[model samples]
Target chain A: MTVLSDIGHLLLTADLWHAALAAAVLLLLPALGGVISERSGVVNIAMEGMMLTGAFFAVAADLILHDPWLSALVAMVAGGLMALIHAVVSIRFRADQIVSGIAINIFATGITVFLINRFYGLQDVGHLPPSELLPNLQIPLLDQIPFLGRVLFQQNVIVYVALILLLLVHVLLFRTRLGLRIRAVGEHPEAADTAGINVYRLRYGAVISSGLLSGLSGAFLAIGISNTFVPNMTDGRGYIALAAMIFGKWTPFGAFIACLIFGLGQAIYDNNSIIHVSQYLLSMLPYILTLVVLAGVVGRSQPPAADGIPYAPGTE
Target chain B: MAASSTAAAGRPAPPLAASLRRAGRAVAVPAGSVVFAFLMGAVIVAVTGGNPFAAYQALICGGFGLLCSGGENAGLQVSNTIVFLTPLIMAGVAVALPFRAGLFNIGAEGQLIVGAIACTTVGIHFAAAPAPVLLPAVLLAGMAAGAAWAGIVGVLKALTGAHEVVTTIMLNYIAQWLLRFLIIGGPLQLHNGFSVSSPIGAGAHLSTLLPHDDKLIVFGLPASVYRVHVGLLIALLAAGTYAFLLWRSSFGYEVRAVGQSQKAARYAGMSVRRTIILTMLISGAFAGLAGAVQIAAVDHNLTDKYFSDTTGFDAIAVALLGLGTATGIVFAAILFGALHGGGAVMQSDAGISGNLVYVLQALILFSIAANFLRTLKLRLPAVGRAAGTPAAEAPAGALAGESATALADDEGLA
Candidate 1:
């Protein structure tokens, strides 16, 4: 009962909601990435690796260049390169996408640590100065609004960017001709190929785009939310994003809602000082919730029809 | 009939040649993958301004106890490799069995963790029992716990048509958090120790192969320095059991039939759902046995080291590289065990990060999955097109087909 009261009181505070939105945005970026990649018929379980790679390069670049924007760009490129390996192996060579994804994850973990050892002599990556970190934007007048202002207006620049990207992805995936073609290709590549859609080109583009989004999320995590890059700093956020994608049934808006739920859990865990619950047990909630969703309590969540199948031309 | 008889007599030489070709092709892809990975690893090391040769030399010295420049003992190193590979053999069987059923068991890590937890709980509770009673109790407890953990996945998959890959991933995280909860502040925590459980009783320990005696010296070191335990024999027995279960049992036939085509299996009067559930139960039991043995033979308690344990993940590569055969799995386990043993030496002696092992592992996975050598048209004379295709295609095909069938079933339900 005390725990319930604690959570209830915490929910009413603007600070909790503010932190929740920020965390949700963090998960939202990769969840959106997952949505794009899986919708293109490529099973992308590699966002965790891509995000880790992005986070490492982002911190590394920021240390060298001292510019957050440039560092973010470097991060995206690094993530895209990792994804390119996955795309080439799974899409071009017709390999198992899951195995390729696993390889990407393992490779990212190894390369990042190996680079840290080479550059920093087995020491920690030094923290960035406040001036070098991504700035928080205070929307002028809107910031004066009571509770919603702190929750929505005065937030990290990346949070705003992510919210905008969320809208753009929603519109792009459902409201455009390109979106239709992506869905068609995912549903039936052979039929789409017959319809003159370049299935390979679309899949490659979708996969790379997922990497870019995941990279941006990683940059936000390393440079905005935190100042230094710890080993495995992303922890399992990328995987949580995967859960969000599935919980939302692969739609951008659906995934966003799922992210908010998981993000709330993260926010609550962060405020564990007041809540009388084990943080570790609290941490398991997202995965448990996802499992519940998968168990059909939330209705069946179907994937793209041709997802995970290698596109062999002229095959049935 | 006359022509057929003449051809058979004339082509008598072809039988021996064909068998040789068959054996050659079996060894080619996995060998090629390892070579490709090592070459790529060398390139990565060189590009990063490190001496690849020095690093590899240290690795070889550490793994096989040869060409040592660091004054490490050859006998001790071999013992270390054996210890490292012991659990991997069982875990490899865990992954391999599920693959034979067309189910990807990515939750081996989770299963192993719960098994460790259960084994610790039982061993601690039964501290006063004799070795004859406590030893088997702890191991069976671990197996039961692991099976129950994985049974949730099997039930969901069988009833709801949920994809095993996604469910397994979720379960892995859940088990990780559960383990943390158990040891940190839960009942399993030791009195004064941090992030560790109390050691099990002496009766629960799986005695080392060598007598624990500081006075006895072998190969210029105390016999106690060698940590190789009786788990090696258990692991080998487990491998033999896996082979027998997979090749000679009626259950194995059902599993393979379901793996080949679920619809055909269902048409042939086998319950696909039951086989799916049973395969996961058995698979999880193997993984659980791995954890129980590690606790009994090596660690003897739940420790922070288990947090970063990669034995289950390494088993995936072992199963793949071994081509899901008992002998192949043993050989692959040895290679991986050697790499792990060598990694520490490489880090200390060559000033290279031990993470290079993981990089090499990832490269091997990429090469194997993509069949890069085959794609480059570097086919060996023994690898006929048909023979090479099945080995590379089976895993991918089975996974894709299983999910497609699951999706179709879901649509019918809807």
Candidate 2:
């Protein structure tokens, strides 16, 4: 009862809401990316790898360049390059996407550590200066509002960017012609190819776009939320984002809602001192919730029709 | 053509030569993939301003103990590799069996963790029991825990049409967190230790292959220095069991049939759900055995080392590179075992990160999955003509195709 009251009290606080929103945005970006990538028929379990690569490069670039924007761009490019390898292997070579995704993840983990050893001589990647870190933008008058203002207006610049991306992705996936083609390609590539929709181009673009979003999320994690990059600092957040995407049925807005739920859990986890539950047990909640959702208790979640299948020309 | 010509001349081709040629063809892709990975690894090392040759020399010395510039003992290195590969053989079989059922079991890591947890729990509880009683109890307990862990994935997949990949990923995290919870202040934590469980009783321990005696010296080192244990024999036995089960059993046919086409298998009167569930249970058991062996022969307790354990993930590469054959899995396990053993030596001797082993592993996976040499052959007609026999498609191809239909069937259920 005390634990319940403690969680309830924490939830009522403005700080908790503010932290929750910030945490949600971190997952939202990648969840959105996952929504886009999976909608385009590529089973992208590699988001974790792409995001890790992005986080590594973001810190590495920021340490050298001292420009957060450029560092973020570099991070995105690095992630995009990783995505390109995944694309080439799964798409061009007709390899197993899951195997490719696993390879990408292993590659990211190995390369990041290897690069760190080479450059830092087994030392930690040092902390960034305050000015170089991605700034928390406080919207002047808007931040003055009681709880909503603190939650929405006073947040990291990347949070704002992610929220905007979420809206844009929702619109782009549902309303636009390009979005239609991407969905068409994912649903039935052969039919889409027959319709002259250029299935490969759309898939390539969708996959790269996912990498970009995930990279941005990584930048947010490394430079916006935290000051220094630790090994595996992203931990399993990218995977949680994948869960969120599936939980939301691969819709951007739905994924955002799912992210918010997971983000709330993260925020609560951050306030573990107030709660009586073991932190490790608390950490298992998101995965458990996702599993419950997958167990059909929350209704069935379906993937795109042709998802994970390589697009071979003239194939039925 | 040579065989055909010889046969046309009223005599069959020599059995040895024909078998040798067949074996050579079987070896080509995996061998090429390894060579490709090493070449790519060399490029990565060179690009990073490291001496690839020196790094590889160190790796070779550490793995096989052939080229030793660092005064490292050869016998110890080989022993270290044997210890490293003991669990991999079973874990590889775990992954390979699921692939045979067209169900990707990414939860082997999770299953292994739970197995370790169960083994530790049982061994600790039965600390006063005799060796004969405790040993089998702990191992069976481990296997049961692992099976239960993976059984969730299988049950959900079979009943609700939930994709095994997503469910397994979820379970993996759950198992990881559970392991953390158990060792770090949960029921299993050691009294004075942090992030480690209490050691299992001596009765539960698997005896080392060499006698554990400081007084006995072999290969210029104490016999105790060799950590290779009876688990190696168990692992080999597991591989043999897998081959026999896969090739000879009626259940094996059902698994293969289900893997090939669930609908067709169902039409042919085999229960697809039963096969799927049973395959996962058996797969998990093998993984559990791996975890049990590690506790019995190596770690002796659940430690923080299990937190960063990549054996299960590495098993994927092993299963794929091994072409899902028991013999191939053993050989692949050996190669991977060498790489893992060599990694530390490379770091210490060549001033390169041991993580390069993982990089090489990923490169090999990429090479195998993409069949890069096949593509290279296509581009070069000269090369293509030389290898007239088409490369055997990897078993992963069957898995890849089956997953698509399986996923499609899920949508129909929804």
Q: Interface RMSD (Å), each candidate?
A: 2.3, 3.8
Tens digit of per-residue lDDT, candidate 2, span B247-329: 89999999888888777887787877888889999899999989999998899999999988989999999999998899999
Q: Which ten residues in a row have the lowest lDDT in candidate 2 chain A?
A: A307-316
lDDT values for all models:
0.88, 0.87
Report the TM-score for the A-chain of model 2: 0.97
lDDT score, residue B136, model 2? 94
**How well does chain A score by TM in each candidate?**
0.98, 0.97
What is the fnat of candidate 2? Answer: 0.73
Q: Over the true interface residues, superposed, what is the Cα RMSD of model 2?
A: 3.8
Task: State which candidate has the highest DockQ.
Answer: 1
TM-score of each: 0.96, 0.95
Candidate 2 lDDT, tens digit per residue, A1-316?
8888888889898898888899898888888888888899998998898899999999999999999999999989988888889888888776778888899999998999999999987959889999999998999999999988988999889888888888899889899999998899888888888888888888888888888888888898998888887777788888999999999999998898999998898898896586656678978888999899888899888899888877766333
Poorly placed runs, candidate 2 (over 4 Å): B1-18, B376-392, B402-414
In model 2, which residue pairs have backbone atoms overlapping below 3 Å?
none
Error of 1 at A276 (Å): 2.0
